[model samples]
Target: MAIEKIMGTETELGISAKDPRGFDPVSGSILLINAHRPIAEVKSIWDYTGENPLLDARGFEVSGERERPSQQDNRTINKLLRNGGRLYVDGAHPEYSTPECTNARDVVCYEKAGERIFELCLASANLSLPERQQIFIYKNNSDGKGNSYGHHENYLVDRRVPFDQIVQGLAPFLVTRLIFAGAGKVGVENGGERCDFQISQRADFFETFIGLDTMAKRPIINTRDEPHAD
Candidate 1:
């Protein structure tokens, strides 16, 4: 049987207000996103009727609290762009999720579009702010203060594939692929380590071999299974 794949990218942009006395990432993110008027229409409510995050790929569901948010809570941060992408605030950072792409090349194009969207929003938002109250957004993850943001990718894999087989075959590739796939970083965190330059900014932060936590105890390969568009 041939396997079909659909892929997309999600990025949480690092944001900060330039004011030293008062810095608010949440507000900064809101301003940055709202600056793009079209994204302001991202107030659509998310349907979470059958969603499950704790469901593992191993045919067992874990017990955990999964609270669904109302339209108000979600509408404030989410914007569905005409290009089929999404722009919104996830926690304190501005996030952009590309629309479903059938292949890697299309994924790249949409992801680049997301960046241009952010840049346009930033420029517009800065025009409304005071000269000293500018906002800065970084493409890289981590703030060099033990805080880590995320740039996650999602792909559609065949559910027929065995979980063990997927992990076994994919894990090694993920680990070594950083040699060419990394975004590069200066210095290091997670253990006070110092480096002139590193291939991947996210490499030293993986404290656990296998886990679902993306912020605290980072994992090389996330096991949380979600059947997208199911």
Candidate 2:
């Protein structure tokens, strides 16, 4: 049986606002998120009622409590674009989540379009900044420091397939496939170890085999059971 191929992606671009005093990424992210607000054709709040970060994919609840997205997030920083995509501030970074795409080509088009949208936003946002202050955005995942951003992808799987089977079949590919799929990076070093380059920037950061947490102790298999079906 063939499964319908539905896909989408979310990218968090690294941003820096530099001035004579210092640099602020939080302010830069906020500016980029709000850049389209003034000219937005339709403003729709993200409905968070269906969100359940605590529900595990393994069919049991997690121990820690789920924290609802704050009211400030809905009112201030989130926007549903006219192109059907979503732009919002996630943590200290501005994230662009592409609308549902049916095939690989459309997915690529939408992802590239996201970068153009950010470029336009940055151009608009910079006009309001001081002459000496400027904002720069990078599509890369890491900040060269210990912190890292993400390029998250979503897919729709047939409900007929057992979840455990799905995980078992996909684990090896997800763990080792980075050899060909990784975004190339500069050299890296930890303690006395050093390497010229790495396959995936986020690979070395995984601390556990399964969990719902994304920032700390990131799991190879994300257990969060948020429904992707619409």
Candidate 1 global TM-score: 0.90
Tell me the tens digit of each residue's lDDT in model 1 across 154-218.
87877777878888898898888888888887887866656888888777788876766666787
lDDT of candidate 1 at residue 131, scale 0 to 100: 84
Ten contiguous residues with the weakest lDDT in model 2: 184-193
Identify the runs in model 1 with alpha carbons over 4 angstroms from their true place.
39-44
Please give the TM-score that candidate 2 achieves against the real structure: 0.89
Q: What TM-scores do the predictions have?
A: 0.90, 0.89
Top candidate, metric lDDT: 1
